[model samples]
Target: MFTSILVPVDGSEHARKALSVACQLARQEGSTLHLLHIPEELSHETTLVWGIGAIAIEASREERENAGKQVISRAAEAAREQGVTEVETVIGQGDPARTILSEAKRRGVDAIVMGSRGLSDLQGFVVGSVSHKVSHTAECTVITVR
Candidate 1:
């Protein structure tokens, strides 16, 4: 049972699925859910959660941060809706994989739950996906939802 679980929210469908899985685990274990969002410029246009609309690759830093806010807020609310009592939301900046690892360690979470793919699927395929990097290096359990 996870005493604390870190979930990286990117406003993707797979992220929503990962959140659902995290919520399920959190409910069963009475875990604290930490939802973290890292705003990064994408190489391609991407759709966000709750129909917030697509974010252009040329979107400015402020625009990306704005979308990140909406994402983290909505994700926290979703956790509450799923019956998770202890929910925390955070926004960080930097490389996705490293930042996620940093947050997990900072929060001392027992697990990191995230989507197998994010907004940069093509880029991920070219390089290694953020989930792949985190899963390979994280100090704790990592659950990647497809």
Candidate 2:
């Protein structure tokens, strides 16, 4: 039983699936779900899950942050819809893996549930995925949804 679960959302289908999994865990244990979005500079236009529009690579930092907000908001809504009453949203800035780990520590979350891959699929294939890094480094339990 996790007390708090951190779910990093990037508007990717994988992330959404992870959120759904986290919701189930939260519902079972009466846990809190922390939906975190870390704004990344995309290299290409990519359509998001949760009905969020595509994010262009040329978009500004502000635009990316706005999108990140939407990502967390939508993830929280989805978690709530799945019967997770205690849901929190966060928009973070920095390297995705570091930010996620930092948030987990800051919130004292017992576990992290995140997508195995995010919007940076190509980059991750080359340099390792955020979930991979976080899972390796984090002290808590990690469940990565493919």
Per-residue lDDT value at 130 in model 2: 91
Error of 1 at 128 (Å): 0.3
CA RMSD of each candidate after superposition: 0.8, 0.7
Instruction: Supply the TM-score for candidate 1.
Output: 0.97
Residue 47 alpha-carbon offset, candidate 1, angstroms: 1.4
Enumerate clash totals for all models, in the order shown: 0, 0
Tell me the RMSD of model 2 versus the true structure.
0.7
* Candidate 2 lDDT score at position 76: 84
How close is every model to the real structure, measured as TM-score?
A: 0.97, 0.98
Per-residue lDDT of 1-146 in model 2, one digit per residue for the tens?
Answer: 89899999999999999999999999999999988988999888999998889999899998988888888888888888899999988888899999999999999999999989899999998889898899999999999998
Model 1 residue pairs with clashes: none
